[model samples]
Target: MSILNPLFEAVAWVIMRIHAWLSVPFGASSGWAWGLSIVILVMLMRLVMVPLFVKQVRSQRKMQAHMPQLQELRKRYKGDKQRLNEETMKFYKENGINPLGGCLPLVAQLPVFWALFNVLRAISDWQPGTTPKYGLTIPVVQSAKDARIFGASLADKFLFPLPHQTLESRLVILAFVLVSAATTYLTMRQSQKRGMMQQGPVDPDNPAANMQKYMMYIAPFFALSGLYWQFGLVIYWVTTNVWTLGQQH
Candidate 1:
């Protein structure tokens, strides 16, 4: 089995459970049921990461507060790359500072993100003679395939064509891409605003601070990849981003 099989199974189990719970009211094949399952999954994952998120925010504050020391280290060892690396790590260890801790929430969510992507990809590729992965029954898989959100098939992608997808599907997927990208930008902006408010003006010399600024300008463009991503995965992206905005707000 692939390394991600476990994650796929876990994520798939959650989606199946949510879908089954919603199936009664929304019907077994309702797109809203399936779509909401993905959205809710994102929400659940974020909820579970609350502690990590809080730690990330707190870590950022700590890192910001130590910018002067970090800058001094950088200057002190400007010509010794190896020594700088060693000292930076030593300093972090001494201070209980994990420079990478701020990345925990996003990094933690990556496996689930890719697993959900592959799960939807598997569903999209499922065929009459093919066996389903993730312990999904044929009927359940069929119902999932039939589920539509905003007139777009969850399995469809903007890059897919012709007999495989409808114009409406393309439109809905494009809308999702745009919305995802927009939410991504807003989320970053909101976080930047909060950071500035909490920490005062950003220090340009701080590597972490610089990285944050760079991502604000670059990360939203990644949402455009939704053009090639499954509609269901795009839903996850949009929901996660929207959650970030609301959570940050």
Candidate 2:
């Protein structure tokens, strides 16, 4: 097994235990309890990473504000790739801006995303006959045969007419996915616009800036594809994205 498998399993175990505890306290089959659990998890993760997010945003703003200086540096160091890199590093150091600061939140979230995926997979694939070889020993496994959240099973139908889909369930999933995609796209667009507005004007001749602009549009499409995977993940992502949107505002 890969090194990450253990970590994934541990997260899954924790999620399961938490779910069990919440179920007991709040009563099983309470959709609110389950939903609240996911929200709480996302909030906790976001709160922990808030410092990183703040640093990233500050660094991005600094970079945007210093674009002119960076451009001048680039022009001065033309034909010297190594020197350009060194100069860029020096600039970041002098300005107290870590070039990698922006990446910290994304990097930190990778494991949480995997953990959520594992937890959702466990919930969707719950069955009684499966031998408990792993650390996932929840006593409610026998009683928790159904993975229905508000009468909708976690199973999804990617095709049209959505087989075995109830009207309410379908609507909930659709709304969740649409909100997820829209919020993600809007948050990214707002961030880009804020950055660009800070930078004054983008250089038409700069391919790098143009490519970054293109990526800002393309990323949401890739992010929205997660709806095809599982609604649980979509819910988690949308919840987090909505939180981010609120925080940014």
Candidate 3:
């Protein structure tokens, strides 16, 4: 029903095809195959955005280089917000810098995340023997319905445990949530450390510095919202966060 439904369907199709291909060589359970497909999907998505990530790094470095000038501008135009905005834009243009460059890659990835979320939600809600409107084939959906990993279905979630709701499922889901939250926090801390190394020590009073500080908490809080998300999606999140951890390290 949403405008993004078509994109979600396309992403789901790709995931299902990849899972089918991987299943041929890996005689693992269907749940594991589906989980691997999600991991691969995240890797592929990140790979495609490598150039944008590079651009983000460059932009951040440029901002770091201009920090002194930016601070002076803030001091000089402390009261005139309109003039400050104009001067900031001019400064960025003169330096060939994009203020939003670091944000662009993150913004671009949002749709992909949303698409995956919907695709996994569809799988999570599918009943055995029912036809899925997107993603896997009828047989695959049936397999998914019966699939369980460590007694927890890939489609299960803390907010909506499957019909079984066994102790093992509860433990697995809890572990996934904790790991996801921890990785997210680590990623933010790592990014902040790198920024400090490049930009010098941040002055806590600066608005930009304060915003970055706030972001440390905000990102992890958002990650925790995945407690309600499907385990399949949690797998994707955990894998992606791990990739980021390795990449940043």
What is candidate 3's local distance difference test score? 0.81
Compared with the true structure, what per-residue lDDT tens digits does model 2 show for residues 86-197? 9989998898777687788878987988776765566556666775423566454433334566665544423342456777776677777778778877887787777677
Error of 3 at 40 (Å): 0.7
Model 1 error, position 121 (Å)? 1.9
**Which regions of candidate 1 deviate over 4 angstroms?**
78-80, 204-207
What's the TM-score of every candidate structure?
Answer: 0.91, 0.79, 0.90
In model 3, how many backbone clashes occur?
Answer: 0
Model 1 Cα lDDT, one tens digit per residue, 1-249? 897788899888898999999999999899989999998999899999999989998898888788678889998998898999999999999988998997898899999999998888778778898899987778778999888788888888889553668899999999989999899888888888887887778776666668888888898899999999888989999998888888778
After superposing candidate 2 on the true structure, give the runs of residues whose Cα lies further than 4 Å from its correct spot. 17-21, 24-26, 76-96, 132-134, 138-147, 155-171
lDDT of each: 0.87, 0.70, 0.81
Better of 2 and 3 by TM-score: 3
Query: Candidate order by lDDT, highest to lowest?
Result: 1, 3, 2
Q: Which pairs, if any, clash in model 2?
A: none
